[model samples]
Target: MSTAAHSLSSNPWKQGAKDALPLLGGYIPVAVSFGLFSVQAGFGVLETILVSAFIYAGASQFLFVAMVVSGAPVWLVIVMTLLINSRHLVYGPNIAPYLQKDVRWLPLMHLLTDQIFALTLTRMPHMTPSDRLRWYVSAGVIAWLSWILGTALGAIAGDELIERWPLISEVLPFALPALFLVMVLPRCTDRRWTITMVMATTTAMLLKLFGFPNIAIPAAAICGALAYYAIQVRPTDKEERS
Candidate 1:
């Protein structure tokens, strides 16, 4: 049949894998740092890998390691992990509409991370449903593998690397935020989104300045989302009333 459709059918997963390559640049170092930090924080090698494999969460993992090192109880750690990752509640629902209807998408939920979510959100609208699922899984596999590789490297060679290149370790902690910023800035091009982002950033910054860094993130997210909703819904209500 059609050339474009044939091309998509030929190797959609490979196209998905290619799209995910940019995220790898940020993910590897952050994940490597996770492994290295886990060791420094008293996790064994197997424990480090398993945590990366199972939790697959970046920020929550950092919090988990810190709490563990501080002698937090297991149940507390699990609860805190859930709290820190609760944003996934929002992320999951956002992407579910774009995913396959079958059971395969269920397990892929475990593969969801900030980078994967961002990548999917940006690209999925342009993809056919089948291609979207193929691309999502393909990109997710790359991200997952990269994290595992980074963790293994950190577990094995992290100490020596730290000794030789201390700044590399120092810079790793900033990678996740930078990656998020990169993803967000482009998506904020619309006027409504621009206003929402500004509101969120201002709110979050003010909170942080007032010594509430912990509360700043969720508050900002809520403020931004609500601001966008209000802006969007007001016009709809006006139209309906008229």
Candidate 2:
């Protein structure tokens, strides 16, 4: 092959797509489940598809559909959706250091999701800034397309399938958490991260047990981040002082 052809074939975009292939297994089923739930909750197929295309947030979209179905006020829905997605505030800063300064931020930010952020966090540190940007866009775009396609499929035919095979409705709900664990579990090999995960999980469970479930996730996240910083940074500072 010509050098140019070889270089093009090996580009970061291709690598990103290849790395993201595993996410399809996870994204599609969850997206389809979201579509099915949306339709069952009274959303039109077009509306379901549009939600996946536009909102593109997995858990938040589910929350949006539920709140809408329950006759939530417009302002309430907006506030709740933003609250659920506020994790992006953390995700953005964590991943920013790996990208080039000039990479257009809007498209990349719009496409950001938990899975994409996790994937990029692990992969981008080893790549050049330009390559990181390309890789991130490629992975994000592929993940986004799969989500939309899956939602379309479910919106069009999911209701009938659920009727024909009732167990499917039971199974689809688990797919999102399963997929998330698959993506995130590997990152726990680091001691500090593992500790943070434990702290977060414990905090979330305790909050839920105490009937404060609404704030559980965000509170757990904050607690876990604080724990990680304390464990990972304070010792370094002490050593420097010595």
Candidate 3:
């Protein structure tokens, strides 16, 4: 343990890793698939690993690759990417309480992602500042490592595995949705979040087949906002003739 961790401050990095391990176990297949697709799409091993490691955004990165293949304009891709990742802004405040002021904003910013954000938010309400940072960093690092390794392996051996297993062929492409379900369903507590999730699904389906808008990030934000609104509108029964 670092000397710094033993103080009143909880070690954010270590705890983050602990929470992140279980989640990373499930992320393996999806990460590899992404790596496979990225390579097939012409991204080299270095590019694939770097993006997974640094960008840390699977949906946006995948979409970026697809757009590149389609020969979309660079500006359009950039705009779309930003639009898709806009949800990050919301992650800051929700996690702010748990974060240590020890680091500047940039380092903290690096750790934001759907999985980490969701995990941190759930535990943030109860955490001391120290534990929050440690947990988030640890979780983020684990996610980062798994993603890099998974993609590297996927890109290298994607074809062989796909050819060998026919079931993967049949059950293919479900990981993203499955992951989404796992991450989002747990956070649903009110009608708004429910509606938001439904809308995002519908929108994603509608646009994905045709073109234009990307649905993943937008859908997440939509659901998140609606959930927030619904929870806020939570009604309380009035006192009777006090």
Candidate 4:
């Protein structure tokens, strides 16, 4: 291999970017949908773009636009958005141990998204500790840029495009969720993860049925974590008793 090719392959940042390439297919369409929806809900193109650039939370941004369009108060919007995104509280610590201790994490934490977290979780085990941060940052930047680009496109010309091809709108919303499933499903091969997945899914479904849809996702996540802990501890407790 050429020296330059070998160098690129060895660089954590480049490897991260390469890993993140598949995420574009997901991030772009969903971000475009967000931008288009925000504009249609009466936001300016710049405003829509800023939402993607700054807020950067996927589904929460859509929820924010919807709530604002419905004339919800500012405090409520902030609270609801935070609630929807509270899952990140779990995401951060789970990935933190894999990162180098000396690396500054506060600024980089903002780039943590569901997709990026999942990507890193699965791949970081294979990476050296020092490479983790660089790889994550590179992947995050790529995902972030794709989202912004998609938002800009949708904000600027989404209406015209949708009018020209109505079917695109229907399909865009599914892209991100599909991407997430593809990343997560492989991990379910582990029995603990499979049980956790089942528990989480059941909890979410039960909550939705009980008329508590807004809290379902976070609650499911909490339950799943607890369930996994219980499963993990049972083996230890049996060993102690023996």
Candidate 5:
């Protein structure tokens, strides 16, 4: 094996696409939905593709499309997008130890997004830092490509597709979250982490009921991290020493 090849996790763009291939196959419906919805909302192929490629954050992208479709104001759409993808901050620190081997913190955090962070941290812990970074860049950037292509296609071709396919609208919105679910389910071995996650999600639902859905996710995640540290970290640390 080439020392470089053996050193890194894998080529980032390639690894990302490879890992996401199965999920991407499933995501085509979701991508197509974005395309159709964007066109319906006055977005052309260019606008649709820009949102997918640049924003590259799934929940935000879908939420933006939903807002545009509802005839909402542009500012409201922006706020919603920011709120939906705010979890990237939390994802950054969790992966710091692994990436510390090569790059500094800012650059490491630069490429991170919610899904990419989760995918890499859970799956790439044992790989070379180069390979780990490669894997992350892989999924992040390629899924990004898939998103833009699908949206552009839908924007240009959505109405015709709906007239023909009919079922895609119901399914596309679920794609990114489904990919997240797949990533989340596999790495849930830490009981404390699992507890924190469930508690966070439950809290978000309750907060939403109280008329503050926009702030729920970050608030819940913060509270979960606090609760986990308070309840479990000390014991786990002590156990590790023995």
Candidate 6:
């Protein structure tokens, strides 16, 4: 790459770790909530940590535990996790071009989640390829560690916290969904994105009402992606009017 790119690439791992610090503000609470809920759903501390470690998809893990507690079958939980995480398919291609070709990518794939995905999208294009990888890996590692620690804390005290303040029991589960809304709302100022968001939410709700709750997320994702892609590929109304 160019000299400029080389300079920017320097200290990428450190910079990436530093940049990821802000994300902890959101990650810690949600992860701890997830841990507490996991215990409430009958998971032990070790089990909760393992889910955070291996699954690592925050919202999906939450949904998985919920489904399990509701007596949903194992197949249903697995399928829902797959459907919920399908969004990562979209996240992957966006960053693939900037990544180096290596085995390290395998582990990185496991680290991929909504927060890091969004973080990389904004920051990776500015980084050199080497720095991009360093930043990506380092940021992911920090998020991962923080999540585990938060989960441990939650598992330890989640029961007591919920017992003392019953409202917290109700509110903790919405943490990730609230975070999702915060992310989506900013982008909704664009008409096309507004339409896409409405379509996705409507599709999910309609599916759930129709007794397809388990498949609602994946179906809505497919519909929303197609709707947005169609809008993007089409000439704008101004172009057509012209």
lDDT of 6 by residue, 132-193 (tens): 77788889899889888889878998778777888876776566556666655676767677
Candidate 5's C-alpha runs over 4 A off are: 1-16, 65-80, 100-111, 207-213, 216-220, 234-241
Predictions: Cα RMSD each: 3.6, 4.4, 4.8, 4.4, 4.3, 4.1
In order of appearance, the predictions have TM-scores of 0.86, 0.87, 0.79, 0.88, 0.76, 0.78
| Local distance difference test, candidate 1 | 0.82
Put down candidate 3 lDDT per residue, 34-58, tens digits, no spaces.
Answer: 8889999998988888888877777
Residue-level error in angstroms, candidate 2, position 132: 1.2
lDDT (10s digit) by residue, model 5, range 120-147: 7656765666566667666665656666
Arrange candidates by lDDT, highest first: which order?
Answer: 4, 2, 1, 6, 3, 5
Deviation (Å) of 194 in candidate 2:
1.0
**lDDT, each prediction:** 0.82, 0.82, 0.71, 0.87, 0.68, 0.80
Candidate 6 Cα outliers beyond 4 Å, as residue runs: 1-10, 66-74, 164-167, 184-194, 205-213, 233-242
Give the C-alpha miss distance for residue 6 in model 6, angstroms: 8.4
| lDDT: the better of candidates 2 and 6 | 2
Clash pairs, model 4 backbone: none
Tell me model 5's lDDT, rounded to 2 decimals.
0.68
| Per-residue lDDT value at 43 in model 1 | 96
176 Cα displacement, candidate 3 (Å): 4.1
Candidate 4: segments with Cα more than 4 A from true spot: 1-9, 206-212, 233-242
**Candidate 4, overall lDDT?**
0.87
The local lDDT score (0 to 100) that residue 168 gets in candidate 2 is 82
lDDT of 5 at 22: 60
Whole-structure CA lDDT of model 3: 0.71
